[model samples]
Target: MKKIAYLLSVMFLFSAFAPAAMAKGVKKEKTELTAEQLVRVGEIESRVAEIKSMDFSEMSKAEKNSVKTELKEMNKEARALNNGVYLSVGAIIVILLIVILLT
Candidate 1:
């Protein structure tokens, strides 16, 4: 009788989880940017790369500060274009792990 009960409980648990496991396999499509937006992001990235490759020693203090501010703004724009998909995926994984462990 104890063996039957354990088998039934295991079956019930598997039934409860099977759908969620299957659902996790469904891929979420990423949003693609329009051509203009893509071009803007590319421009920002290239400009950032150029700034990174510059010789800081050759610049005046004010120029250095301006470059720093430009870099920050470019980074912010780049992230804004990404729409937090990576963050959402990370949060979903963390939540799924928590749920699995708790169960």
Candidate 2:
């Protein structure tokens, strides 16, 4: 049936990329990045979105490399920021509890 075919194709697509996605996720979480890296990520994300919106099958190797680099750097920055937020929130809660106890 057509439905079965569609499902098979979807499964194939997912299976093909699942391992790569998992690896990327791990790599992203392990890196420490700077603000410039974050900005590069935003730029790369936007470029990727644009590329997806279009029907271009051919992209320059340099362009692809640039985007990949930006995304990787951005992921690193995000992980750092996420940890920073957790620390700040924990500190704030501790301070609030101390103030409440004193008052």
- How many residue pairs clash (N, CA or C atoms closer than 3 angstroms) in each of the candidate models, in the order given? 0, 0
Q: Please write out the lDDT profile of model 1 over residues 29-86, one tens digit for every residue.
A: 8989999999998899789889879999999999999999998898778888887735
| TM-score of candidate 2 relative to the true fold | 0.31
Instruction: Give me the runs in candidate 2 sitting further than 4 Å from their true place.
Output: 1-56, 84-103
Residue 97 of model 2 has an lDDT of 56
Candidate 1, which segments miss by more than 4 Å at Cα? 1-29, 85-103
Q: Please, what is the whole-model Cα lDDT of each candidate in the order they appear?
A: 0.80, 0.64
Model 2 — which ten-residue stretch has the worst lDDT? 94-103
Model 2 lDDT per residue over 1-103, tens place: 8677656656765675688788875643555667887786677678657755754357777777776786677667656555642447876775565455444
